[model samples]
Target chain A: MEQEKRPEEVKKTSARKWTESAKKVRGLVANMYLRAITEDKPVAWVMFTLCNELFVAMDVLPVYPENYAGLCATKRVGDPFIDRAEADGYSNVTCSYARIGLGYSALWRDTGEIPPFAPDGGMARPIMLVGSSLVCDTRYKWFQAFSRYLDVPYYAFDMPGPPAVTAHRPDVREQYMKYNLTQLHGLVSFMEERLGKKMDWDKLDEIVRRAEKSYRLWYDAYMMAGRAVPCPFPAEDSFRCFVPAFFMIGEQEALDFYQGLYDEIKYKVDNKIGSLPEERYRLLWGGGLPPWHTMGIFNYVEDRGALFVFQSVYLPLNPADIPDRITNPLERLVYSRYEMGIRRAEHDRKLGLFGACNFVGLGNPLLFVDEFKVDGVVMHWLRSCRGATIGQIYQKRLLAERSNLPVLFVESDMCDIRDYFEADWKMKFDAFLETLETRKRAGA
Target chain B: MYFAGVDIGSTMTKVVIMDEEVIASVIGPTGAEHRRLANRVMEEVLRQVNLPFDEISYVVATGYGRINVPFADRQITEITCHARGVYSLFPTVRTAIDIGGQDAKGIKISNGKVVGFVMNDKCAAGTGRFLEVIADALGVRLEEMGELSMNSRNRAKISSTCTIFAEQEVVSRISEGVSIEDILAGLHEAIASRVYRMAERLKIEPDVVLTGGVAKNIGVVKAMEEQIGFPLLIPQEPLLTGAIGAALLGKELTLKAVEGGKPVERGTRRLEEATFFE
Candidate 1:
């Protein structure tokens, strides 16, 4: 009772708990993003996950510079970014995200919004910058510049090549994986030292379990959409389903949230309450999420007696629930979840598309088409998404020849309302439908 | 007499059987495993109406997965199916935009048939996948994205032309503290711009019909309208327009086949049998 606890001891205890809390938060966030990546949950969910994780980790926020660049394009931000990057010797077409990010950085520097690292916000600076070498080589180089400029750590995750086309060449992937893992481990160790704490393996494991449960529950909800009446869960809401992915992946709270969601969805399914009006067609959707402004497609189809029964949102593999490898904790850390594997696989596929001189042919639309059994395909040709637009001709031809199915191609953006012309689309579609009827009558 | 249209899209298979008196339809996943699902959906539709499958006159199949439909009497390209579907739904439709999960097609129509079509089958940028990617990035539900987007007074521009890159871009924007509404607006505009390019290439005129999964997105519809400077005719059930057209065609064919007194083929008969119960 007479012995007073030293200030140092008190500080140590506080630091340990603080670091533990942070790890738990980061773990959950990581799990969500990892699941999104593994299951190809959606780009938005994945980004949210990443941002949350970075914030929890107390690291510099990882911004998707490309999104900002896109805004610039429509908002006239592109010109300044392009001009700035070019003036700095970056090419005009050097991955617009990089240009925009740099431009924003320059703007921030001028505005004093971003200051050098210190304990306070005004003085705090980024300690590290991370980039994935999945989409383009430009990001790799661009992040390098950031690393040098900020005088902070720069980490690049190398993605594998396509297994289908590359014949399973794992050298590049292995090298990248190893490098990324090494760097990640070092980062964690540095963080532990700075916080004067060791990682709590038990807590990490608990977080992972929560993430897995949440993912399963969300998946069950999506499955309910296949019922006759279907659930009101629109494919557009798929991103929101990943909320647990952004913040609670490895936490007990995340598990509880998902469990609750699962119960709600189960109740709906049990009640036979379809998401759309009771009608005849129970169509499945493939490809990416339908844009918000264009949600009318669901109502339009549903009104005509069709329901989106299934979708490719079910494609991602579940997170592995197996215990971490005691012998190689780093391996567990690197490949702890299946999302990373999925991301790597997708990244490789994108690389192949880029290499094939068809940078836009990144996603395999035919894969979803064949898997989902859609009666007719409505291919949304988004102007801003080159990756989804490259292989349309080939896919269409294949579908026509192989499936003898109807494919409707509509051109529009996911977010912008200005680019969609209802009158034009309606006239074309009406005639197209008429022809389908005629063909049916003619027995073509 | 009834007509039927069977559209086997990449994601799901659909069958529409329309009689002068009523219309019945069925949809299910399309795949090697879908033969049974298709049969079940068809059977269910017919069962609802207490109709016999044999009553259907003609059956036309369209879509990427159409060939897998064992019950279809004839197979037609999605282009033809959409053309027929659009024409039947809106006889005045001169142009059509059919956006599915995987591909996008812009067709010029005349007299209820496809005349000239410009399509993008190479990538998924302008397709539902693009929106899927963006929706995923924003952590918004696909269904709620449209509503949220509509709430946005400011539109954020998303420049990554590639789905993957655009996803990354979206992440960066969020981290930078850009409002989600702005990002959504930007994304919608990007999609519209792409479609506008295609329409320009196709020399699209007014009286356009917007069909497919993407047409359900109000933001995209409004964006397209703004970009093309024209009004759009959206069918009550835009996604099923192709299937509806196909069903109508099926009815016409069945009636013709019955009138001709030529015994319907086994495949046609099977489709009729499967779908007539409703």
Candidate 2:
């Protein structure tokens, strides 16, 4: 008989592993609301994924619905929440990450109780919900749907997409950056009025420094993956290390967590040890985010003697990417927006594809294929994600025609397990390995 | 040396035996139990070839029940097997569209290898089972519906991409006094359009072959030619292609064993190591 499928947990690694730090961050996330209820502190649910650093700088407790949704997806326990969102008439076509958030908020609002499965007793009720534009059309809209459920005021910021700063439209980059900075300032004003407090410029300067150090260390650790042989930390560990940068990006703990991870991966690469025991194949996980329920997929690959040396879904923020060193918190916030918009323009104007675009969409695997000594590229085409799933067929054709490497596209959903079949994926993965081997033997 | 491949599909189980030449083969409905049907079919094929099971050089099991074939020495995916099977039958075939029981695939082939491929997103609109449902609704036998549809003077249009909704539309057309022949022709056209779009996504090339149970349907084959705008090379026995591919893979593995001086275990990880989370 087949063994009963189980959910993946954090794998134990050396040096009082970063998972311990990540777990601490999760506890702090739960405490965000605990303190709100106990100490009467104000909490704002930030909808923009990257602005958590700003919220931390404001010294207010911050709750991230996207983070909570990811937590459920990673635990493989996102079913009920996803179903609830669907029940609320949030079409199945909506992003599963957003669906989990929508369903979870509705459950708390309708039942007036927290879900038993919510990580750390679930998210804290916020005084307001903040949103932003992203690669998907649904990111900001999903938050708007949740604001109605919680009866909270929703404030959204514009986050632009690819094809930025074209030569034909030089003013486009300036407009996009200016729009984001305006949104950030409005959010700060809204929070200050609601919390009955003033902004802390000195502490904000300290946070800017800490966040700078944190993002640099995170980028440095990931770059070690490009070494001839990468560090032995499991692929999921990369996702796990993302916790601090997401929650406490400006805190000393974020820097400490990243430095520890960087040192460990560096040691393994120097010693010629790899994440997998045999390490016969090196794969590049590009194109889409990992589906939380089927994370067993990684272990399944690891056991097959393949090491996923690089996954493109990791955060692309780097300290060097910051174009401005302004100490003023508001100016620094405005500069960060300019940096993001300009990076997209540079990516278009120059072939700076490796810089920032790796974090989202196809990101063009042109540079990654050989730089990582990639044996093959495995990309998932998710039904719920429009931008991520777009141009996958074109990506495969171009990769094959240019690099002469096989690109296997797995079809699955992000958080929804009903859309995934374990047996089907395993067989497909097995066949993919066979194709790589067959190509290798043929000297193709 | 003898090689055997068992393809345990959702609707049917097929076994192919390969020697210096094609030895023997067996096909049966998969029924309620894959294990029992797999064992029965393998034994029957060996009996037809007058060979003992132990004489087989290597065994490969494929399809949805690949893991359930406890007796097989190796388990492979039907995707690779389908490519291998079609390549062996029609080596010049550069692209293959296989409409299996539960799913449909558009595979790009070059040098007798799968270079690129696409499968219908988890849906029943363009599969063999979809035809079965329509045939059952029309009170026509699955095989005879092909000839019945060939007689239609006018093919009605089927726009719904969902099999359930399309079946409901067929029922309405029936009550509205639409001929069963016209309705069946429309169903064929609908499935062909659905599958043609998937093939076009891979960019259809010359010498394309159509395989699987649906290949037996002349109406679907014609609809495919009309829709795909390319001729398809239908194999002598479409259903046996995946099983034949499995046998060829088994043969390749056996050759590797001869060179390496050790048997190969196909499954790379123990179930516990694959527990993933812990």
Candidate 3:
């Protein structure tokens, strides 16, 4: 077969460009998509919330619809897909990622061919579709809908409740863990049966180790750069930095990418290089996925001299500590996932952080207001995606009650542009910056 | 020591020239090309005071087209401008609700400084534009809505979520032989309730000031007062408050710069009709 050409590059809407790791990941992801489309590798349609480490071990190239939806949005090609879905009776207020994903799938189903202009040559048709009852509520149903369109088998893994809930109920915790382990075993059997491939235990162990190292590097980079005086790694850059830990996890490339990121960030910190020329105000991206289409809003804020130092959404999951006694790779993988979830929950409980399914919200921004030295919190209140948006009002109230850190809720959708009004949003943002200036002057 | 402020809003452009007190002010419609209209409004205000452009010590721009005024020393958001403007008039004012052409915002102020604020979302509900759309559909003049609404004993209910739907509801009510006065009253009630609910987010305090083009509508002020459970203190010319505040802020900035032994950085005082070609 002839070499698959790389898709045309998407333009950067924001002033701050993606970090080096992100640029590399873009190529790697494009290659993965091309390879899967050409049937050069086994493919699995996956969601971001699931642990793709298993797919890595199985040698299946995992393609994420959520990531593709985000890309389409960033590339400004999401509107048609979203409009198509909405026209077909999908509620406009449902999860936009699901709408874009489903719409893309429908186009393929109807045409029996991938849309030529689809972002990243569109996602590869999977041998099996995967979902997780994790952070987002729309995953299982969305994947189920996709299975119907693609006529492929679908499977969903159930995540246990927050660690805070399980802390008090040991029996419930035991049952939940048992169920999760059974699901993992079932997933392995299902994969083996469907793909006619055996589990590579040693390869899985090596991958798990690599995933752990990548996660550690990601955590260290965020902690070091995130806490810097001027915040060398702003949220805009960190969003891209998340690609390695999120998509390429459990791979040697993931480890290399993060290491390079750590080195780059450390150098920036050491050289006193900041994301902005003058970071007058440090802010926390309060919660919810950003409006990918207008992500340049981050640059807009930065232009006003307010830098987003930390955000809870894209924070890396806590790396799991595997017991040395557990020699089996399967046991290690299951235990690692369970430990990551529980440990994160416990940490969040200690820090008074809000919990979201999957590992979305692990820490509270208010708790780190002093530590991060943030003067304000700007939360994107997505019209769709209720899972990320719930409790934001209460969180703002809590911020007011606990700290003087002002919270600005910028209401928009994660993918849909219709939910955003540029003039109204700019006015709101300008006013928010003024409030921050006034508060700073009054020494509040 | 003249300081001028130009406020280019979505539907109106206002300019205020002041020295210790307001000397001259101009209010005019903001046309399709607001940038050019902004210059004309500024020129008119300067003409009213019979002062050359160079005589004004500082010029500050505010409102939606705040940045478009090339001759202004600095541009401030309407939120801050409104708060400062209201606070200057009512020193004890703790909260200010400004419903403008396209958006309605509630500003929480303390000791002449803005502490917090909440504004309407992407929707035009409870905004001046919302009322205008409904009024257009009802074939009623914008200025007469307040008087007409007051005459209604039984007002019809209108949805506050979408302007188009609200207009449809108004049309349907009219088709049902409902009085236009009653429908106008309902529209006032809908907008009033929406703005009041938004202001409540800031924990509405007493001595609340209402400033904006919408405040001129007596019907809205009365409806707002009823919902807020407090009398709203409105300025003599509500539309000019942002411009007034901008001018005052410019004066303050200039004074502060001088007091700190620093140069007051300002743009060239070239007040001319603005052109897109520039």
Candidate 4:
């Protein structure tokens, strides 16, 4: 692992390692649920909060409904599930991810058998559910809705106020972190009671070390995108690259996959073999979820010789850089759980804000925009994820004014392609490219 | 020597041919054949100017069917086009409100290009279709509602967030003996309010110009003017602004290309402002 060979890895890896890592995660997810059904392994359904790695370390099979919806979407079979949820009275405005999951959950409740549309073995019935208030508050209600309908116990965890405050005092930061850490302890205790087993500290430590290594590998891999000229990857593949960071966090497979990916990407960079013929415009995807179903919309830009070097989706792999404030292995998991939000709240608090949701939605992408040498930006104004989309206009203006680069704001949905209009997006790209061309003409 | 712009809006298609001066313009309804309609507009403008299609140096297509336009040399967004067109018409214009048949937008412009903008293609309640639906409810012509609203004794209140529900509410109001004048006034007020809120999202500054087909409606225009707290500069041919802007962009693009190479890069030529949280 010579540091110098790193830049050459991009071309050597090509797109193979990325696809392989994602395929492995998809299989692992399928198998996790399969074992839960066949072997009766106790299943814990997970949400998009922090501490997912903690759940993986716990050895409980985690079933992610949100991730499952993405799979259904990728397979292009999500419409029925989404339509079924709408028919079940969850309105079309409810996120496609949540709608699809709810539809599947409702069908399971009605039939007591896997629906024909269910991917792989279908999500294993969870003995318990875990959720948190993060980027989308919809998850809080989405999970709560499932808990009530499925008749399963649900645990809601996180610090209050995004980093809770007791109203009058603004600086309850230390007390707040400890309280959140305590909540994680409560989750562990609940798991212990449910599984009827005591804690295993030594095994948890080993999992943390492996998970941290994989996470660092993921961070390093993304970092190479900026280091490599004419980024060997497309931002459309960001969701795929992040699959390991999401699912295989504690697995040796994630680390190895990322290491191979790193070497390949570096090889490409050294060979100067770019993903696009000539990456004239190195763009940064500022905010919004990648439309898993309709990523081909980017081919229009790719045709114009622009490459998206970094996406905000991959920005959450911040574990490699952040200093571990807590020495205890278990507590570090809790720290990772709430640290992002705490730092977010701290950033918000310093900037005169209160009761905010993950400002990583605002914070990290800006860092990447500069670090990636982004010549322009494309911000998706996702319709369903209101939390992320709410910052869209403000962030777009700020990015343009600050970066002094043309920004393209397009309306779309993360998992739902039905919400996308291909012509509208294409026209936007044409105009955006014109703006970039104008900037080029002005030599600005 | 010549550049053309085709704007295939949801309801109507507009074409503008320009270079140094506006040579010709055409307006027609946008039908199923977006490609056909785009070419029709191109032929219409070419016939008006007495020029062949190949004589056109470049073509920029805009609006909903922008990409669908078969003959477009390049497609541009209505947001940018509207800003550029409005700025060309009213150079001091800082904010442009475009209320089209399907989408309503508030674009903030600086230096004759869009800086920030918000568009409502999400719902029909905030667009020109809102008036169309209201007209259907009242059994009056779309153009008649404006004049009828101006004479309202007292405006009625309509509070439906959705277009269908609002239309239903209008029907019941008609049944309940509410005058059409009052209801029309209320409808204008309702749409103006929605558009105003969207404008506030972009934080409108003065020298505002109103573009798009809906700018032709005096009632909606007056209502929006009052709601936005400023008079608007309506274009001579309000619907033609996007097409005109596209043509202008096409001309500028042609000029830049003819200058031998890419646009000259000047100034500091370096930007390193990396403060993450602050």
The CAPRI class of candidate 3 is medium
Off by over 4 Å in 2: A1-40, A165-173, A318-325, A348-362, B259-278
The true-structure Cα RMSD of candidate 2 reads 5.1
Where does candidate 1 chain A have its weakest 10-residue lDDT segment?
A9-18
Question: Each model's DockQ?
Answer: 0.07, 0.52, 0.74, 0.24
lDDT of 1 by residue, A413-436 (tens): 543344465544543354345444
Give per-residue CA lDDT, model 4, range A349-369, as digits (tens). 554444353534354445666
User: iRMS for all predictions?
Assistant: 9.2, 1.6, 1.1, 2.9
The models' CA-based lDDT, in order, is 0.56, 0.74, 0.81, 0.73
What digit string (tens of lDDT, one per residue) describes model 1 on residues B190-252?
A: 887887787665668879889887888888888899998988888776778778877766665
Q: Residues B1-278, candidate 2: write the lDDT tens digits.
A: 88888898878899999986578999889856644547777878888978887788888889888776766887888888999999999989889999988889888888888777777767888999999999888889999988999999988888787889999999999998889999999999999999999888778988999999999999999999998787889999999999999999889888887889886554332211112123
Native-structure RMSD, model 3:
3.2
Residue-level lDDT tens digits of model 3 in A1-444: 011222356567643563565456567767767877887778999887547788999989898888888888888788767766776789999899999888888777767878666877778878998888877678889999999989999988776554454543578556766787787788888889988989998888888778878888998888887788867888877777787677778978888889999998888889888878888888888788888887788888777888888877777756667779977766766666666766666756665664633555434565467778888898888999898888687777778877867888788898887898777778788888888888887787
TM-score of each: 0.46, 0.90, 0.94, 0.85
Clashing pairs in 2: A8-B277, A9-B277
Ranking by TM-score: 3, 2, 4, 1
Of the candidates shown, which would achieve the greatest lDDT relative to the real structure?
Answer: 3
How would you encode candidate 4's per-residue C-alpha lDDT over B109-214 as one tens digit per residue?
Answer: 8778665566665578888888888788788998788899999998999897589999999989999999999998888889899999888876789998988888
For candidate 1, please provide the TM-score of chain A on its own.
0.59
Stronger candidate by DockQ (3 vs 4): 3
